[model samples]
Target: MKKVLAGLGAALLLFVVGLAVYVASRQHLKFSVPLPAVAAATDPAVVERGRYVVRNLASCPICHGDPKQMERAQAGEEVPLSGGFEFNIPPGKFYPSNITPDPETGIGRFSDGEIARAALRRGA
Candidate 1:
């Protein structure tokens, strides 16, 4: 009985070590690479189309527009997008990043591609 128990314990220890080694090795594998860049749009119509797509389909206005304005929308006020809203996170804190086009206060310095990367690609 003692010999049988000793052998079973050794086997379990060896199995756990082997599983750890396999998992550690698998973490080093490469998955994918970045794609090549596309051509820029110089046409006004293309720009307008892109803007419409972002506003309606992507729903960029939801986070970027003023929270007060969104509330007023229910009451029939035609409030233009002017972003300033706080996002609450648990464990006791919150942050509100400005999204308005105001140069001094918001993302006026970022290029269109940077914005697209953040919104579309979910890249930081």
Candidate 2:
């Protein structure tokens, strides 16, 4: 009985170690995307068009915050985009990133390309 228990314990330990090694080996996984060489749009018309696309065409407001805050934002109020919204799903809990322009707590330091990559391909 003692030997059987010892063997079972050893097997469990080996399994855990193997799993850890497998996961660690996968940390360097990479995904590639072909991003075109594009400069920031400085044109007022283009800027306004992009803003309109995000605010009206896309569901950015609904995904970013509660309805009340979205309404205020739609009413031309300055609403911070600091995201800490949590979603509990069957897979796990996920906290959406804070996308505010705040340098400390948001994506202020990230380049536009980096932000685009994250938004488009979940890469950063």
Candidate 3:
């Protein structure tokens, strides 16, 4: 009985080690889109168009808008894109990321290319 238990424990340990190695090996995934060296568009018209697309087209307000005035946002009232909305899904509550350009809590430091890649690949 002791030997059987010991053998089982060893098998479990080997399985766990193998699983860890597999996971670590898969960390470096090859993506279809390479990180582009694009810069942020600074033209006034382009900026306005981006804002319009986010406000009207993208579901940015629903997921990334301020939680305090979420109702107004859902009703199409323009609210600050603060992104504190808590989603109560199957796993539990999840507060989406702040989409503001506040530098610390938002996407201020990220380059335009990195932001676009994340948005395209991970739906950030």
Candidate 4:
């Protein structure tokens, strides 16, 4: 029994040391290459295609709603996606930003490039 306990303790110590070493090694590592930049869309057709992609493929509507109806739609909902959702992490609340097309309440004032950057680059 004593031998078994000693063996278990040694195993635990070794595991903790291994984990510390791995974390320290990761802290010193650096990326050697930069991420490639997305190309800009020039043609009107390309811009329209990008809009379609953002609307359908990206499911932007799931978070942002029709600007005029957003207030009524979110009145009773807990996870309205207009910035009122609780996250498990940090033991606090997290809310999704309103992506509506309303200039005052949503991303309507943001330029196309800014929107694209938020979507593709910042993952916001």
**Global lDDT scores for all candidate models:** 0.66, 0.72, 0.82, 0.64
TM-score each candidate. Answer: 0.51, 0.61, 0.64, 0.47
The digit string of per-residue lDDT tens for model 2 on 1-124 reads: 9999999999999999999999999989976876545556899999999778866777565556544476688787656666656788867887667777778988888677777777654544
- Candidate 2: stretches off by over 4 Å: 1-28, 32-36, 66-78, 121-124
Q: Which stretches of candidate 4 lie over 4 Å from their true place?
A: 24-29, 35-38, 61-124
User: Best lDDT goes to which candidate?
Assistant: 3
- Candidate 3: residue 102 Cα off by (Å): 0.6
Off by over 4 Å in 1: 1-40, 71-81, 92-96
lDDT of 3 by residue, 13-103 (tens): 9999999999999988986767777777899999999889889887777788888997787787888777876788986789878768779
**How far out, in Å, is residue 119 in model 1?**
2.6
Question: What does candidate 1's lDDT look like per residue over 50-86, in tens digits?
Answer: 7777567776666666786887744645344555656
lDDT, model 1, position 3: 100
**On residues 16-92, what C-alpha lDDT tens digit does candidate 4 reach at each position?**
99999999989867544333455567999998997677555776545554444456645633232344333456766
Report residue 111 deviation for candidate 3 (angstroms). 1.2
Worst 10 residues of 1 by lDDT: 31-40
Candidate 4: residue 59 lDDT (0-100)? 61
